[model samples]
Target: MAAQGQAAAGSASESGGSPAASAAAAAAAAFPATSLYVGDLHESVQDAQLFDVFSQVGGVVSVRVCRDINSRKSLGYAYVNYNNTSDAARALELLNFTPINGKPIRIMYSNRDPSSRKSGAGNIFIKNLDKSIDNKALYDTFCAFGNILSCKIATDPSGESRGYGFVQFEMDESAQSAIDKLNGMLINDKKVYVGPFVRKQDRENVSNNIKFSNVYVKNLSDTVTDDELKEMFGKYGTITSAVVMRDSDGNSRCFGFVNFENADAAAQAVQELNGKIFNDKELYVGRAQKKSEREMELKEKFEKNIQEVAEKFQNTNLYLKNLDDNIDDEKLREIFAEYGNITSCKVMRDSYGVSRGSGFVSFKSAEDANRALTEMNGKMVGSKPLYVALAQRKDDRKAKLQVNIFLHGSWIYTTCAFMLFHNSECLVFACMVGEKSGEFY
Candidate 1:
């Protein structure tokens, strides 16, 4: 695997010896020489189906549908191995975008070294594209330049094109030629912008230099009027407009906006007035952002806080099921008290105050939680054995359940299909035997 090669190489470099370097070199040499990575496969496509489709062009030595180990559900990608490099190349040429299970599969040579991809050596970004363009159309448009490693169009959740895309070529010359010829060309009646791809962090750093003319201010004294707000900020900037936000009842909301005549003036006002006391309250000032931008910022902050909390309690929380009907919060606490310091324990109940036969327990330390889990799991309490494990977030539990259901359904469908085929074969054999023996009525 790529990870193994990287680890081995790192070890070799750290040890400064030929043995480790030779081992790393051997590992890199032995990996996936004739293997093709097949991506964008449908979840239901398995190894057998891939082999049947790919074997027409070459001798397939192996096919593997990558899957999640826990649920055994397809991960939407696979690997196909051929006996020789020529066969592998043929398969890649003939079946790059072959449709299976109503979805197209993308094929590429399996590259164990990830540096070429990560370095963004020959990647280009295309924007302002027509919404009609997709992956295949983009590929067709650019393939004349050189060998493309990958091409993709950004799309929304509903699968609508987002008017932008990325393409990475195998060689920098190809990428440069494409950009030079097509950077401002009209495609589908839209003039597109094509350039070398810039990473998100770099783009963000560049955006920090952009100018703005509108400023937001909060923590104003309730009695401050629009004129007073203007007077307070007029010292640093030429105010084009100033307004104190008011409620339906016409009372000040203690926040307002100021639009300066120039971006530099607004920036200066913000720099000087922010965090300064204005009418006994510390003023907060910043560039005014659109509602969507504010919402996105808040959402990111909320998710970060949630992740921190989850990490803080990661190994110290336990979920319990098959609880006895007689168990209550106090009894749950009593059961886990011997393991370690019990922070919180609760047995869930319905509105009618009846036991739900499930509970949660929190410990002050991971060791205590692990000890409790080892001792209590599958242990008989009253009429059933308890199920205990580390608690998962609601979203994670839901996703696991969905994967399990999908796998179970696929298994049932496959079993039924095999049964039907077997029955038809048996009927044909019985009819032939009867005809040959002259026993048919």
Candidate 2:
């Protein structure tokens, strides 16, 4: 798929087309393919199992079941490639939602380019869905409007519907028709809300403009009373109610809430009073939010901070595996000290204080780490070759592994499967040797 896009772009550039035209050609080429993404497979499903099912429709080129790099567990999805597009289409029509290992699989044309999907051209969001509406029922309901690229009922971990879902058609007209005809219509005795799907960031931006009549205030002086608070904020707005929060003994808790008669007045009070010194303390004032909203905002802020920290240390830390047993913190540092100044180095140990054969090294700069990684990776250290790479946070590493497994599907599946088989054989051989040497006895 990627090769086709690259070839299309290359031909367009060779023909003296504008850069925009070249990019357009590349994107156009990416969509026409004979590969299909099969999702929601049972964990036990493998490439051979998928090939058996898909090959019934046509000549199968390749099948791959993506798995986690570390756990070697199925990711509940697979990719099947056919020799021709017609057979692929036939498979999609006939085998979609077919039960495999007692679980129904969803099939769709594999789209490598994300721009078309992210454009939200033909997507609609439906809410207030009946609990019993599953993926198949949703698909059957909307398929009449037009060719649906994808339809799903948002489900919780236990597989119960979450009262909402998304349906994406191949044409915007179909999505509009569904929204017009079905918005506020009764489905399963529930009034459903159908509307054009808005991305989360866009939704958040829209919510930020909503007006509020209640304002939150903090950093109050201990002696401040409700009457004092009302008097201070009454200059900007008509105070409907004001209270300084207190403990059971009636001692001020250093925070309070003020309600204005109108949203405009509340907004003006917040704008003027925020960051203003009152009772010798700076006050923080803003539109009051529910607990969930405050939590969501805090979570987003925390994630942003984490991303900034990750970016600040990118490529400056290295993870090392297969370390020699003799390698301690000082020894590890000495090994990479020639490349750069070491910030920290540690060989991981178990509770028994034995080296776990892995460690980490952090350099003062990314350049030094890169130099050490390039020179030391796979180099023989003791009895085994070292495995070295840039250290990644747990979540980042998992995401990268998933992307690698998806993008390099077939090759990763084959290589990892073979490695697993080879390791099993080596373990058996070691057991045999140990038995003969009476080591087990």
Q: Which candidate's TM-score is highest?
A: 2
Per-candidate Cα lDDT values, in order, are 0.70, 0.71
Task: State TM-scores per candidate.
Answer: 0.48, 0.52
Off by over 4 Å in 2: 1-31, 224-282, 288-441
How many pairs of residues collide in each model?
Answer: 0, 0
- Highest lDDT: which candidate? 2
Q: Which 10 residues in a row give candidate 1 its minimum summed lDDT?
A: 414-423
Q: Summarize candidate 1's per-residue lDDT along 1-441 as a digit string, tens digits.
A: 111112322332334533323222332343325788898887678899999999998899999999989857677789999998767766766676778987778776786678887778789999998887877677657655556667788864324677999988777887897787778777777788989999887889887767999998888899999999999989886899999988789998788899999999998988999999988999888888765455445445444544344455566778899999998988888888988898888787889999899988888866678779888999997789999987743433311111011122102110111011110011111111111011111
Q: Write the per-residue lDDT of candidate 2 for residues 1-441, one digit (tens) a residue.
A: 111112322331353643333322332344456888898887778888899999999999999999989857788888999998777777877787789987889877787779878888899999998888877767656655655667788874334577999988777887897777678777777788989999887888888778999888888899999999999889887888999888789998788889999899998998899999987999888888765455445445444544344356666778899998999988988888998788888888999999999988888876677768878999999788999987753433321211111112111110011011110011111101111000111
